[model samples]
Target: MRFFISVFIILTSIAPAWSDETRLDYSGRTVIYHSDVKLRGSQKRDVRYSHKANFFGAVAINTTKKTNDSNGAAWGYHNLKTAQDNAMRSCRFKADRPEDCVLYLSVVPKGFDFKPKTRTLSNDAVEAYNFLVGWSRLNFDSYRSFAVNGIHTWAYSASAPTREAAEKEALEVCEETFARSQKKKDPAWAKAVYLKEHLQCRIFVTFSPV
Candidate 1:
């Protein structure tokens, strides 16, 4: 009888453990997932636009009159405008230059099938690279976004032909650029020279081409 009781207790304990691994909670405003591809199971259901009133994502930074500071990328809000405002506010509030807060990125939680027309890319490669990586685009078919933001430096690529391939290439390029900066050994040479926190790949798809 003692052995049976012990066995039963072990099974019950492990059962909850197994369930915990697969358990996904999609509560208000938190990002459960971000992808162009559809998710399986209960995660497949869409977040109604009306429901989007409670969720928003954004990045913002302080200005130096001539340039923008690093350390933006605040996320998870309800209103886009409010998100942008709060992000900029956060930057300015913590910044040496308090008056130069600016919005760098913002997006609401969109559905899986959500796709928007692609805008014209920049003619200049450098500027285009910055624009693509820093800003979110309208959903277009086969689109991808990847970025690496480190201390005082960042890089990104988007709307590539392939998903994982583009992401890998973007990260590689970003890492390569970061590595070069490390080799140069600028003023902040002693600081860590890699994307320790902000390395990510995001995908969005749209049906219409514009």
Candidate 2:
């Protein structure tokens, strides 16, 4: 009896430490997410044109008085140093003092592009969205809705012959669950949510007259 009581006390004491560590769950699988913050955007721009050779691009800014007179790809350079130097020189050419210009940002091997698998919106909602194989001739739409509370989530998905129907079904399922909670006199920590907007969905989808 003493050993069992001691074990219970020990577990209760360490419960707080376990609660601090959060886990990520998707499709019934759970994994630890060490960080809570998510990246929404960055202050960077892609090159308008890229050279076939190993080319470097850079940005230089006039730091004297926070001027918008910046320069990029002023003179094509094979090396980063040369690119940085030229960019600064170009920026200084338009500056009141030539020495006020400094390198602000740089991008190398211009042809390389980076894309994120998921996107977070301004509302602090993280989203994972993709379109299945569909065209005007044959439309099969699928959508998912989720309600989240802190680290917990309830999700529902539906597939239909049209986008509107699929979206409607997903919302109905999610809201039905919410309505049940209200009727049962049980308070819910989460609000019903819809995750339909993709940050870069238009890049992949194109509309044509059928």
- 118-175 per-residue lDDT for model 2 (tens digits): 4211111122122222322343233322222111112223234444444444445434
lDDT of 1 by residue, 129-159 (tens): 4455344445445445434332222334455
Scored by lDDT, model 1 comes in at: 0.34
Model 1 regions more than 4 Å off: 1-130, 133-139, 186-210
| Model 2 lDDT on a 0 to 1 scale | 0.30
What residue runs in model 2 are displaced by over 4 Å at the alpha carbon?
Answer: 1-54, 64-76, 110-210
TM per candidate? 0.27, 0.26
Candidate with the greatest TM-score versus the true structure: 1
